[model samples]
Target: MTFVKNVPTQPQILAWLNHVKLFEGLTQDALMPIIENANYMDLKQGDMISYEGMPLSSCFLVLSGQVEVYRNTYLGEEKIFGIFSCYDLVAIAAVFMPHNRFPMTIRAKIDCSVLFLEKNSLLLVCKNNPIIMQRLLISFSAKLYELINNIDWLTSSSAEQRLGAYFLSLSSKQGSQFILPISRGQLATKLGMRYETLSRLISSWRKQKIIAIEGNKVMILNVTYLDELTLPSQRAF
Candidate 1:
């Protein structure tokens, strides 16, 4: 972890805050105070952004790159909860909880920069600002929905079915042709599948000519084929 100096100018900070949906209606002047109290940090790959059970007092905004949020199971195995990328805000709920401790360990997936804002500073701003409070409520609701979606995806079906759905989602997200940002092992763990199982699934897909893989980059050759893999129970969603 490296502290970032030369913080962005007020205008730059305001521009960024404006782009964040949570601050949708906040004015430049309204955001200036929060920006003034913000601390920026640069993190390299493998750096731990936050540790499980650590007391939380700040909310983090990803300036660039990605962070993997995960928890350790009873057997000490890592269970990835989410991957946060650029412009994503994390730990907002934890910051306001009475217990106020991190439930998962957060680690940088690659070199990244993040803006940290003190919880109290943000709460103070929101207290008297109905617009900001509404925004926070909207953001909180979005996160809650996402959490439920993740739980559904995890227990939906077989690894093969899940993998197929994941690939389709990625293709849709990155415009049908994009390189995977994370390693195969990390992805395997994220999808709740064994590393070997993931490799075998990829191999099978490749053999079937459903996708073309060159290193980390994958091109979908058969989108319809992939979509047909949806399980009966998953069809409604």
Candidate 2:
């Protein structure tokens, strides 16, 4: 991980900030302060961004690449929470929480760049701009909803169901064919299954012609069949 010593120019910062949903409608003047105070960092794959319980003085906006949110299990295995990519805000909720500390560890899934917005700077900006505050609330609420859905998924879904839902989500974003963003081991952890179990399920799916996998790339051969693997009640039309 490398901290960027030379600060980005106002225009450079504005270009990246423009894509962030939190600052969607704010004018140049409203965002100038944040742009001025923002810090940039470059992280290599596997670099630790923060650990669980780390002080949350700032939040990050992913300018490029992916980051994983995860925690260690009692057996010293990693259990992934989520993977976030470009334009995604990391730890926004923690910045506003009473404890103001990260609840999970975050690390770079690939080489990435992130812009850090100090909590104090953000709050000051939100004070004068109600629009920013409203956007923050919307982002926070969406994150909360996602957390609840994830809890339900992990607790109630079968391993195959969980893996199917994960594939479907990737297919939605990258069409029926795309490379897996993380390795099979990491994917297993993300879906809350043992590596051998995940491999067996994928092999079974391949044999059944439900999907095809070539190394890291996956092709969904039968979307319908894969969809059926998920909970019937939760399946989307």
Which residue pairs clash in candidate 1? none
Candidate 2 Cα outliers beyond 4 Å, as residue runs: 231-237
Best by TM-score: 2
CA shift of 164, model 2, Å: 1.5
**Candidate 2 TM-score to native:** 0.89
lDDT of 2 by residue, 1-237 (tens): 889889788888888888987787677788877887899999999999999999898889998999999888887778777788999888877887898889999999989999998888888888989987788788778778877778877898889988899898899999999888777887888787899999999999999999999999999999987777775427242
TM-score against native, each model? 0.86, 0.89
Residue 228's lDDT within candidate 1 is 80
Residue 209 of model 2: what lDDT? 96
User: Residue 29 lDDT in model 1?
Assistant: 68
Off by over 4 Å in 1: 74-77, 231-237
Which clashing pairs does model 2 show?
none
Alpha-carbon local distance difference test for all models? 0.82, 0.86
